[model samples]
Target chain A: MAAAWHVRGLVLALLLAAVEGRAEPPEEESPWFVPDHAALQLAGSIGLLSAGPGWGFLRDGVDAELLLGWAPPAVAGEDFLTVTLKGQWHPFRPAWRGWTLRPLTVGLLLSYTFGDAYFVGLPDRYPDGYYWFKTALRPALLLGAGAGRPVPALGLRLQGYAELVATDYRLLHFLQSPATAGTGLFSLALGVRVRF
Target chain B: MDGPLRFAVLGDIQLFLDDGADAVEDLRRRDVDFVVQLGDLTEYGSAQEYAWVAELFDRLPVPSFAVLGNHDVLGTGADIYRRTFGPPFLSFQHAGSRFVLFDSNSREYAFPGNVPDLEALGEALAPEPGVDHRFTFSHVPPWNGDFDAALTGPLEQLQAERGVSASFHAHLHQFESEVRRGVPYFVADSLEHRNYLVVAVDGPVVRVERVFY
Candidate 1:
C-alpha cells in the first residue's frame, strides 16, 4: 500500500516538473521530444490508475501519449503492470466564456501487460493456431470528450475528461454472447489532463 | 439387476452465461444422479465470471464436477478455479461406478507432460471391491493437438487395459463420438448448441443419448 502511494507521488512530481519546464517557449520551437501535456487517468482496462506525458501534433488537434499503469493487488486481486501507447484525434474544439470544450475525441490504444502469467506467443506445447488471441497484449478503442480552460497563473491548461473504453476481450465476448455481455462492452474512465 | 445409473454431461459454457443457465434449468428437470461439466467454464477467467458460473452450478439438483480448460487458466484463473471448485483432478464413486475427472489441458501448462498425471490416474483406476465400471473425463480429447502427444497412446492403452467403459471430453464446441481400440469416447457439444449427453450405465453396458433442448 505504501509503495502504491509512493509511485503515485512520484508520477505527480514528474508531471509538475514537465509542466513547469514548458513555460520557456512554444512547443513547435522546442525540441520534438519535449512533451506538451501530461495526463492521469483512472480505470479504462489499462489499470486502476495510469499516468504519462503526451505530445501534440497538427496544431494541437492530434495527441499521442505513453502511459505507465498499475493495478494494486488489494483492489484487482492481483498486481497488474501495463504500458500503453495511445493516439487520439480531437476534431472540434469550441471555446465559450474562456472555456474550450472538445466534445468529440476518438482514439485507440495498445496495452501490454508485464507478467509471466500472460503470453504474447504460444508456448511450444501446442501446434500453431491453438488459440487465436494473445493474453499479454490488449487493444482497445476510446471515445471521449474534454472541457478545459487556460490558467495563466499556473502556466497550464487544465482539462477534465471522461472516456468510454471498449477492449478486445469485451468486444469479442459481446459478439459471441450478446445477451450476457452486451451492456458490459464499454467501461468508463475518468481523467484530468494538464497541457503546458 | 440394480437398474441403470444415470448421469449428465455438458460442454463448454465460455462467455455464454444465459445458455449455461438455460441448460441448468433443463437439467434440473431430469433424474440424473450427478453432473459433469467439460470445462472452459469462463471466457476471460475473471473472478466475477468464475463466481457467476459457480453460482449457476450450485443451482443444479445433484452433485457436480468441473474439469479445468485452457481458457480457465488465463491470468489468475487457475487460482480461482482451485478456490472455487477444488483441484482439477478428482475421483469419486457413485452407485457402482468409479468416475475420474482430470486435467487434460496439457498445452495450457506449457506441456509440462504431467498435466493429466498418469500416475494419479493409474492409482485412481485400480479395481475396488464394489466398483463395477470406470469412466474418465477431461477438457481436451487425447487425439487433439492440445493434448500432450507422448501421453496419448499410453493413456488410451491404459484405459483400454483397465476395461474402462467410456471417456468423455469437450472443447471443440461440437458433438463427436467414436470408438478407439475397445473404449468409447464421447465429446459433448457446447451449451450454446442447447444439447447435452445423458449416459446410462447398466451393469457392464453403457448407453449414451444426445438430447437436444
Candidate 2:
C-alpha cells in the first residue's frame, strides 16, 4: 500500500513537471502552450476511479498528445499506471465559420501498465478465481473525429469526439472478454480540452 | 439441418489454464455445434496462454469463437488473440438464427464506437424475413457502466424492439440471468467453477441452459 502511494505521488510529480514545462512555447501563436487537461473518470463496469493528465500540442495541422494515467488499484488491489504516447493528425487546421466541419484526427498510442493486479475480480464474486491479478504492457491504436468550439474566456475548448481502437485487426477484443488475448478493452472518451 | 445447433458459452477463463483444460475435458462428452467463449480467455493475454486456450478450444469437434475481455488485452496478448482466434467481434448465422458477437470493455481504450456496436447488431438483428431468432454476445453487460453510456438504453430498446431471444455476456464472473427490455441477458460463471452455458437452437425455439460438470 505504501509503495503504491509513493508511485502515485511520483506520477503526480511527473505530471506537474510536464505541466510547468508547457508554460512557455517556442512561438506565441503555437498551440504548444495549451494547458494540460485533467479528469476524474468513472472506470469501466468496475466502480473504480481513473484519473490522469492529458497534454496536447498542435503543429502544422497536427495535434499530438501524451496522456499519463493511473487507475488507483481498486480496494485491496494494486495500482495500475500507464503512459500513453498518442499523436493525432487533423486534415483541416482551423474552423472556417466558427465551425470546424472538416476535422479528422488519426491517433497511434503505445500504452504500458505497471502493477500485478490488472483485473482482480471481487472476492465475493468469483470464489474460484478469488484474487488474481494479470499485469503487462499494451499497445493500441485510435482513430477518432472531433469537433469543438474554442472557449477563450475560460481557457477551455469543449470538444465532442469518438475514437476506434483495434478495428483494423481480424478480431475485436475488449479488455474484459474471454476472447481478449490481453487487456484490449475499448474506451469512449467524452470531455473538454482546457488551455490556459 | 433440422436438429438444434448446440454451442457452449464460457466466461473469464483467465489464468486458470488448468481449470480451462478441465473444462475442455468436460466438454468432450457433449458434441454440439460451435463453442462461444464469453471473454477473458487469458490472464495477461500472453501468447503462451492464448496457445493453450487455442489448443484446448480446438479439442472440441466444432468451431470456436471468443470475445476479448479486459485481462486478455494486456501487452501484445490482444494481437496474439487476433492471430489465434480470428477477430474480437464475430457474427455468424446458425440454425436459422444470427449470432452477433462484440466488444464491450469500455475503459480500456478511447471511444470504441459502441462496445456492443448496437447499430451493427441492430442491422444484423433486423428481422431476417426468414430467420427465427437473433442472439447477441459481448463481454460486458449494458447495466455495467463500462459499456458505452450513450448506447445502453438504446441497445436494450433495440434488443426488445427486434425481439432478440437472448444477449450473452461475461466479466462479472458470476452466474446471472435477467430480462432487460424483454430480452434475456445471461452472465455466465467463470471457468474455475467448472461451468458453461449451453444454447440449444432448434428450428424457431432457442433454449439457454447452464450446466456444471
Candidate 3:
C-alpha cells in the first residue's frame, strides 16, 4: 500500500561475532551492556549511506543495531534523513585461514524518517482509517551475508557485507503486481563493519 | 496535426504498475497527438514510485503530461512531482483546442478552500481566437468526497460558462460520465480497470471514447 525511496539498513553484528564471537571470555571480558561493533553501510534502504552501533548476542548469532541514515540531494534527487532499528540472525559461520564468513543472514528493520510532512499518527484530516500505514515509519525484511578478519595489531576486525532489502511497501506491491514489481521488489545494499 | 486532434487520457495509475505498463504499450501502438494522465501516478507518492512511474512515462514516444493527485501530494510527494513533471497547473492551446490541467485534490491540504483555483481556470479558459473546443484535466471529480464541497458548484458553473467541452478526472477508480450544468464530466477508473479514454476534436465537434488496453 506504500512505497518510497529505495533505502536499506543494518548488518553490523554478523562479522563482529565471526571475529571474536567464539565466547573467548578471558581474552577480552568487557561489559555485555557495551556495544560490540560499529558499522557504516552504503545503499541499504535506510539511506544512500548510514552508520550505527550494533550489539551481538546468542554467541554472535543475533545482532541488533541502531543506524543514522542520510541521502544528499545530489544522489537521491532530494535530501532525506532517517533513523533505523535493525535485527539480524546469522546461521552459518565458516572460517578459512583466520577469516570468518557468514554465508546466510536474515533480518528485519523498522525505519523512521525525520520531517514535519511525515506523521507517526494520523492527523485530524480524515476518518479513523484514512491511511493504514504511517508515512514516517517503514518496516522491511532483510537478507544478506558478511565476512570478517581480525587485525591483531590494531585490535579491531574488518568486515564486509551486502544485503537484499524488501521494504514493506515494495513487498506489498510485489505480492499484487508480480510482473511489474518482481525485478524491483528488492533493493541491494553493501556495508562494512568494524568490531571493537 | 492533421484533420482531427486526437489525444489519450489515462486515469489513476496508482499501484497497478503492470496495468499501467500494458496501457503504455497499448498507447504506443495508437495514433494520439499527445497523452495526459489524470494523476495518482504513484500509490503512496514515494520517491521510488515516482521514479518507477516516471520511467514508464519516459517509455512513451508521444509527449505526456500528468496532473497532481492526492496521493502524489503525500509527504514530499508534491515536491517530487514538481521535480519529475514541472508544475501542478498548466494551460496551453494546441491545434485550436484549449487544454487546461490543474490541482483539484483539496482534501489533501485539508480543504483550504482555494483549491481547484477557479480564478486560474477562468483566466486559462478565457475566450481566445482559434479555440473552438476546450478540455480540462485534474484528479478527484467534483462529485467525489475528496473534492472541496464548497467549490464544486462554483467549479461546475465556471466550466459551463467557459463552454468547456468536457472536464476529465480520475479518483473514483471507476468509469463515470455525466452532464452537470450542460458541461460533461468524465471520471476515469484506476488502471486496474484496464480502460482509458480518447478524445478527438475536429472543427467544432468533439468526441470521446472509452478504450480498453
Clash tally for model 2: 35
Per-residue CA lDDT of candidate 2, range A1-196, in tens?
Answer: 6377457647765765577466545445445345454433333211133334455544324544455555553421344455555555667656756755425666666554544334333423233543243243345566566666668787555555556555212122243234533433344444334433
Tens digit of per-residue lDDT, candidate 1, span A14-105: 76467547644764477767887888999998889998888889977998988878889865567777878999899999899999998999
Model 1 accuracy (lDDT, Cα): 0.86
Best by TM-score: 3
| Candidate 2 local Cα displacement, residue A93, angstroms | 67
C-alpha lDDT (0 to 100) for residue B190 of candidate 2: 88
Report lDDT (CA) for all predictions: 0.86, 0.65, 0.86
Docking class of 2: incorrect
Best by DockQ: 3
Q: Please provide, for model 3 over B1-213, each residue's C-alpha lDDT reduced to its tens digit, 9 standing for 90 to 100.
A: 457899999998878988999999999999898999999998777887888888888989999999999888877889899999999999989988899999999888899999989999999999998888899999989988889999999999999999999999998898999999999999988999998999988887888999997
Single out the weakest 10-residue window by summed lDDT for candidate 1 chain A: A1-10
* Cα DockQ of the candidate 3 complex: 0.42
TM-score for candidate 2 (chain B): 0.93
Question: Model 2 off-target regions past 4 Å?
Answer: A1-196, B110-113
State the lDDT of candidate 3 residue by residue for A1-196, as single tens digits: 1323332322232433444444334346667756788779998778898877788898888888878888897655557778889999999988989999999999999999866677889888877877788888989999999999999998889889999999988888788777768767899989988887
